[model samples]
Target chain A: MARILVTDDSTFIRRRTCTILNRTGHEIIEATNGNHCLEIMQQDKPDLLFLDLVMPGLDGFGVLKTLQDAGNTIPVIVLTADIQDAVRDECMQLGAHTFLNKPPAEAAVLAALTDALAEGERKA
Target chain B: MTSAAHSSSTRQLNVLQKDAITELMNIGVGHAASTLHTLIGHKIELVVPEVSLITLDDYHQLQPYEADELLSTIWMGFRGGFEGNTSLIFPTDSANTLITALTGEMDDSPELDELRAGTLAEVGNILLNGVMGSIANMLNAALSYTVPEYMECSLLNIFRKNHTGNDTIMLARTTFAINELKVEGNILLFFKVASFEQLLISIDRELAI
Candidate 1:
């Protein structure tokens, strides 16, 4: 199982994602917000991160910046309910590896996971 | 009462602000519609009306009828700098029909019902983020959301129990049409007081960036 981190503020959503990812055979790490996600990354680096764009404390952007600034190159996939070009563009500019609109589809999530793993393997 | 004047001023400001929020939501809704069209490979129609701004107290009067708790509640949880609770909810009948159209499945089948929560949550994720994200961007505010959660409940209960207003309230009306069938509901956008200004500043920064 891939060590994966899923960061979101909602208990319901975080649980849902964990269930779905676990069904796909990934070891899951949960964080309620970006701050916690960042702390988790420091202690245990995951193979992938499924990030939500909005939350209390630091947001997805802040989490991403913190990771990049700390020199970690883990693959980050942003899952947002918002579908806007500007938001997408800003996220891309900020160094998010990929973007998936919120409530991500089965196919989309799987594809992102596949690509993230492949990239991680290449780096290793 | 000073509260009246404050509320009235807030209401006027609310009016002016909603236009921008609504227009932004319209853009997001259009994107969602397009995404659904491709996902379902069918022509789905969206009728987005002028959005409204309401207080947490006003939600109960909005919907008196409570649908089946397991079936009616389209439970979605969102997290952001403006993080709190807001759902892109629909009643049971409306939700089931919408899902059937989007997935090309029957509303009553156990299999379809099993999948409906996830599908609706995804749909809600798109709609909520699309509208709310645009508002944040227009204000140039950096925001993010949580993975959405789905649940079923009374409309009033959903509002009364979960909604802790995100500083300011911005809500809108949007209807989804699949050929002849119409799925109707409101899109609620709540942002915190500080985020409201942070948003405007972000917008200005974007202009500079």
Candidate 2:
């Protein structure tokens, strides 16, 4: 089972995401915001990161940029409520494996998890 | 007050009707909070603390806000399965605070300039669309919406200017806290008597299903 890090400022969204991921038998690590997410990344280095955009004090974009600058190749799947095409394009350009809208559906979450994990294995 | 206004003011919704509408509004507001959370990156807590059907006359009597207090309002007109105009209203100071919080602007000036007004409009657009979209989706109804407009005016003037003879108002009192900043606003939906009936019918149909 892969260890997944779920980061979001929202308790509801975070809990909902974790609940869905838990059913898949993946180990889940929770981070309240971006800084917390980065700290956890350095300490734990989870298998996959479920990132949220628009977090206070260092956001998803900042995390992606930091990781890129440091040459970290951790797979990230961005979950956001912002439906703007521009936002999606930016995340994709920043190396997000996929972009999923918030209030995430169970099927989509599982599908993304499977695909991202597979891609990571392929790269390894 | 006109006869229509008087009639609407006296009409009372039964407990079931009131509860159903209130619950639906809560769901809409919850969705709005989720969207707002993504926009500002702050954890947003939104509660439709109260939902009431009243008339412009009743609103005037209740005087929720100071009569002359300046308010930042974003309003839109909607039509289709049901027709009405809805607006999100916040006291000018609260609006400024909210804008500053979202934009991280140092200026706390009371005046809402063109740029700030535009920013507030975008925020309101996200919220109002969230509410309207969720409600419409739940009811499986089609709706056409007008371009949203932003206005800075007194609370009294807001209703006076938009007073469209239809007196029945569905007021959803929304309170949201973004991080440490708490802002309270009212979402007023003005519907004609017939349109209000149509909404209730739609709700009943949903309940039946």
Candidate 2 residue lDDT tens string, A1-124:
8899999865556766898999999899999788999999999989899998766688888898888788767789998655545567778988999899766778999999999999888877
What is candidate 2's lDDT per residue for B9-54, written digit by digit as tens?
5566666766777777788778888777765666876654465666
Error of 2 at B70 (Å): 0.5
Per-candidate DockQ versus the true complex?
Answer: 0.25, 0.03
Q: What clash count does candidate 1 reach?
A: 23
Q: Please give, for residues B1-209, the per-residue lDDT of candidate 1 as tens digits.
A: 01111342253333434455456667766766676665456676766544444455555434434432433544444444444445666656778877777666674767655566767776776666666665555554445455566777666566555445522344444555655565555554444445444443444454455
Candidate 2 runs further than 4 Å off: A1-124, B1-10, B61-64, B107-112
Count the clashes in each prediction. Answer: 23, 1
Candidate 2 structure lDDT: 0.73
For residues A36-61, what per-residue lDDT tens digits would candidate 1 score against the true structure?
99889889888889998766688888
- What do the candidate models score in CA lDDT, each in turn? 0.64, 0.73
How high is the TM-score of chain B in model 1? Answer: 0.68
